[model samples]
Target: MAAFPHNRRMLLMGRHPPAHPCEGTFMSFVENLIDQVARATGLGDNSRKFVGVLASYIFSRPDGFKGFQKLFQKAGLGGIFESWLSGSPAMRDINAGQIQNALGVRDVNAIAEKAGVPGSFIGTALAGALPLIVRSVTAGGTIPNGLPSGLAGLAGKLDWGDSKVTHLRGNRKRGSFWRWLLPVLALLALAYCGWQMRGKSPPLGTPAAATAPVAMTDGTAQSVGAPTFAFQHSGGKVDVSGTLATAAEKFQLLDALKSTFGSDKVTARLDVDASVKPASWLDRLKAMLPGLKAEGLKFAFNGDAVKLDTTALPEAERVAVSAMFRDQLPKVKVEGLFDRGVEAIKGLKAGYSASELTEALNLTTVRFDTGSANLTRSSQDIIRQAADAIEGAPAGTRVEVGGHTDSQGDAARNQLLSEQRARAVADALIASGVPAERLAARGFGSNRPVGDNSTEAGRAANRRIGYEVMR
Candidate 1:
């Protein structure tokens, strides 16, 4: 195997010859080494400069090297970094998506901005060069305590020409003009031959009749711009129109509207636009709506504004829903409906059985404050009714209180919160004259959402308390 040239090895190892002193900071040394390697690898000047800047930024961070190693492992490119460090030829490549996921969107964007490169290019370049850079800094196997020094002398030792093979027979006389002229003549001959071939090629920009454009049907042509969606709610009825990006989104939106308002009360005329791709940020906004529906309020998303219709809801519910939209979807403007009336809760029978009481509890809507396990004051009346029904059940009956949450936060944290909420509700029921041993509390977190978690209404439905009765 051919060994790396002496100067190349020295540069990779961050060692300078005896004549030069280590005068600059650790970052400067890293930058210098990066520039050399980037140029050697045939990167353009701008890309090479950016690579050096990016490397400096990466290595400057605390735990930078360790963090990159962890990222490599997470992204399944650990072997690539390992191979580069071991001086093996088995280094692997990484794709853009893995890099994006491993480094996180924020870090990737920051690096792109600092490097003055497109975010997409940064991932490709980093994946291509990071392994080699890491290998050089670590020096074969072990990472040094601090950055390597004495990189300045590397410039004087580098040879940009092909490797020269030494003859062993005798010390041959060097510097003959004829020896150089032969290679130059061969290069000129090759260039002439290439030029001769180029002259035979067809002229640039000449059209080929066989490549004529074909007429496309109107339906096959691309849409001019992104499709628009408009929603309007008045009284107890909701009307949805305009275009939806996917058939699935259209179905989901209409289903949610019908589920929240009666099927007859909602009407939609939405067209599916295959040309428009769904925006991720818009999807997140759409996810916030299901919870609002659970509160007896309706929203219509139109352009940059959202019209909130609370005509069929009580004054308290209207205020609460408005606050929620303001907090969750801060970017959109909120317009409220003037009409208001409280929707009465259907009362339970006086002598309901345990099973009937459990069924009633499932139908009842009990709400809590955002991120809090504490039940809202308005929910106490519903809880009291549930307590009364439970008290009327047969003697020696047991009840199970289950709590859940929407899938909007960390799963582990959501699980913990759900458990706490369940316990809190169970405690409330116990304080309302139910026997302590007769009740069991459990949390399902966001695992058992009654509706789609992708919408606010669905999350709201998920973030609820459920009851089950056992003998």
Candidate 2:
């Protein structure tokens, strides 16, 4: 419905040059699909509604799977729908372009001739609707980001008009000045934007009075005193004592500071008195998830003034706690500490005491298969339970995925297999939206066996995934 200007240059990139249309042009795909579906359904009103609604859906879904199943059911085609939405590996590679072509056709006759379906069936049941049905994918929007495959090519063929030389040809090319200056201009623009977004607040630990220092009235200062920070949660409490000049400054500290990797895992509480219980400040902590795109980087924020009470973790994870903090928290900062503190923390991590590492080493594990790293269907529920339980763990807590195997065959082979299994499980957890740095995968093979290698049940128990809480 929303017509876009046809960029003749984009059209030139098509396989047959002027004969083919621009490849993977989203707007054209939607427009063409709407036209085809309208013709195929024979119900003019329904066809129009379907096109408008579906186009809206496609545009809205960044991952391309919003309301896919329901659309198919509405069109009385649910069987093909199931195969697509279930995330089957084969289904993951489906092309949106193919469906677009199918939807653009006005007559079922076109599809019937090409697809081997009967004319009577198309006329009565599908009519012109076959193209629309094809356009409405069962896979939702899992189309791979690449040049068109089978489906895309088909759609292009349907949507594109034959060659017209005038539009495709161009005499002028970008000038040398423009070409060289473009990248430099882009870099300058990026630098300016980054500079604008730099920290507005003073360096961490600068005297609180220098910036947003709180102002206290003579009477209120005498009675309630200055506001302070408390790291306490519903189940635990750790008090941070410091004087801020005003409530406004205290609010800024509470809202602005984030969690640091090496910093202790402490909850924030805004308390009037030490005797009063601290309330949960979950609304204040800052953390981020990975991007849908593979190339995107992961970023996290850790607050200052809070340090982990390391004694609470399991022994294994406690060992590596120093390393994790040192390796992961370089860019992270606390209020009093600027980047210097981050460097100091990194130094401390290298020579972290045995007790510190032991405390940090605490962890939990979930096992996977032997030779194959894929998760069994039966493992889904177990993983779900584990994910739920780990969601609320302390910031110091790190999850280690240990893959175990029964004592059988060559030790080297078993060890390799186990490691791969652990990595696979770790990948799945990351895919499920867990932080990658918080997880580490290792294969222990038969080295850390809990049961005798002779029996089947014992072997099964030996081949398990174990989880431990880091100190």
Candidate 3:
């Protein structure tokens, strides 16, 4: 393998000489030596700098001469040391820090102070040798125990604050040293990566191993200036987050989503449901109910049901707007302005289909008493048409024949008269073979006025019967 720049520095510093009789196998020698030093010093299974430091320190040590010579001889590069020594100072300077780091001193100044080098040259020598020095002390297995006897007190002072002593004693098990010293750094690095990757997808477990970020043209990846609507699926429900700026915008967005995701995919939430006034296309026509606005309209889709949040939209006009949409939109899907991926509503609207209603209800003659609950001969045809209209309703349907009267007498008596009239109509249906279980009679005595009670046309409109589906 080709030598790295730092490896070449190690070679220049007399750290990685080839061995004898290995016949030009410098690469093998370097690898084996690194492996041995790493194992002996407990750094082989760890970081890259450990080996670098070990090599520099061993080469720089005075006693290391014969050891390195043997290493060179073994690797068949014994003749290259003199040639390596002639290299530039840059190589020396870089390796110096490696050695110093290995030695557990902060930098070259501490090493020089320990070595008693003073004056301008001390800085130069320390700078050049810092890497090697650090390597030597740090590589020697925890604390260096063999300082000169004369410096025992000073060495004792160094030992008091020394991490190596505590680490060696406390970290005796295999892999314990790295577990004690490096795990926190590794964990912190991992946490930083995780924070950066919050919304983005991470790899199976590690943030550092995450997939590359994807660019979303429609701004799904990140929220820019535009509104971001996202759905998170959990349990059986999907929580929708983010917002639409205005009522019309909210409606448009909701309409688009209902069109794309089939209204069943998500439940919508809004801050102000009843207070929003959704603008309509007819607002421009002042002559057709001018000054009216949708002031309190708010809505959400929850699976099969679209719920209106009316608490915020407390105004009458807004309430009407909400009711209108609630009553109508479910019948037909309306594609509005903000159509992105919207297509169409899936099926025909659900309500009273004329064919189905006719198939369920039986019909014959229907009659009403003249100005009372008494039967009359002329009213049979209109009653038959009403029965035929509801004939197709399902078997369990609780059909009602509701009656109303004009303002003619006391409120109490009028109520009784209208109720009797409804019963008369219901009896006619029952007589004509409509099942009694499916019929109900109700009466409103001028309570819900469809037209003015003072006019003849109004009275005619008030005296009417209606059918409703109540299944």
Candidate 4:
């Protein structure tokens, strides 16, 4: 929908460039373009290097460049590529949806897995750089032939660090000064604009002070004190202390905390002033029971504060808990909690029955790759903890590793995938010192979904590996 600049040189280059000295030229152009994008997007050193790696991988695909062009055109983002090729100083902004559309969800997930970065971060980096990279490589207006066919070959030929970029300087054959100078100037201009806008913008993560009473919908002004909240994580638990004007507000805060820190890991002590009636608070908290239960979180309001505890959770479950709170509730002061280590699986009673161990394992978060039987790197810790618990279970107990899938593709395929996933988990457990004879793998497919298959959240919930005791 947006208009973009068009490069005359690219228009003449066609769809594929011939193999010649320009191979290095093409590679150099992409390297420079990546550097420019990194500066523009404010990517850190590691992420910037990742962008280079991703570019090499994409280009190495048999039809990667052409595929990207087609994908962009299909997603209605052709204009961005046009603008980048035409050397437009203004970068076109692309959203996460557009990135997902341009690069299929599966491909994006694979890229995220291969890059070892969050999918969200991958989307962001690609959105910022993909157009420019495409434009640079196709500058002669064609996908260059004789390029490396894989990331290893491409990376071997290219330098990722401070080595200077050479070749692919466009029509000018002599000087490289203008080519380097223009991007630097563009970056400075963008930086200056950002600085000029900073004064008018409110600081992030700072809560506004409540100076006046909040007016209620019932045409009444509640004479309430200012709301103050703080959260901290230590010894495998998050401690929340806060004061809110009403019980509804308290419930809202507690719900967010529970979602972020996993209800089992959150311990809240919140106070609702006497100005708000107790009945109001009780009703609100009661209504949230189902949602809390679904998330496996615990909530209770004590005399002074809302007591929340997540100390029993594994480390992987608590990942990104603090970030979620900071991003969603920036005003709430959080201390001693900046994404730390996971709490050892404590509180598992010795000599616990197989069923009890299964229930506890269900509470732990175990993640796997999208559409792959391989367990995610993050799931290792959780599986290890489960193995420890299983080892402690009664001698005759046998644990079932049950895999389930959302109703997305064919039922037959889903069934097979689920079975493979279940087996993968069993294999992992066996490798981690759990006796192979004590564990069995089973797949339920989409038949035994615990949540709705229509919604993404429900689908995520349904696609899980469940542990069941089958003594």
Find the candidate with the highest lDDT and give its number. 1
Pick by TM-score: 1 or 4, better one: 4
Q: Rate residue 444 of model 2 by lDDT.
A: 92
Residue by residue across 1-471, what tens digits does model 2's lDDT show?
Answer: 222334455455552323222222333433444445533233333444434333322322222233334445555445444443323322111122233333334433444444343444333224223323333332233332211121223222221122111111121244643453344334333432332245463211111122221221223222243233333221221223343433223333433332221112222222223332222222233221011011111111222222322233443433234223222333222221112212222334444443332232222223233357766433443354344334434455577777788898899988988898888777776776667777888889889888888998687668766544444
Each prediction's TM-score versus the true structure: 0.29, 0.23, 0.23, 0.33
lDDT of 4 at 105: 86
lDDT of 1 at 31: 48
Which parts of model 2 have CA positions greater than 4 angstroms off? 1-370
- Ranked by lDDT, the better of candidates 1 and 3 is 1
Against the true structure, candidate 4 reaches a TM-score of 0.33
lDDT for model 2? 0.38
Error of 2 at 302 (Å): 46
Model 1, span 396-415: residue lDDT tens: 77899998888997999999
Score candidate 2 by TM-score against the native. Answer: 0.23
Candidate 4's residue-wise lDDT over 343-408, tens digit each? 324566676667767777776655565688977544565677778888888888998999999999
Task: Report the Cα lDDT for residue 271, model 1.
Answer: 52
Give candidate 1 misplaced runs (Cα > 4 Å). Answer: 1-346
Q: In angstroms, give how far residue 289 of model 3 lies from its true place.
A: 42
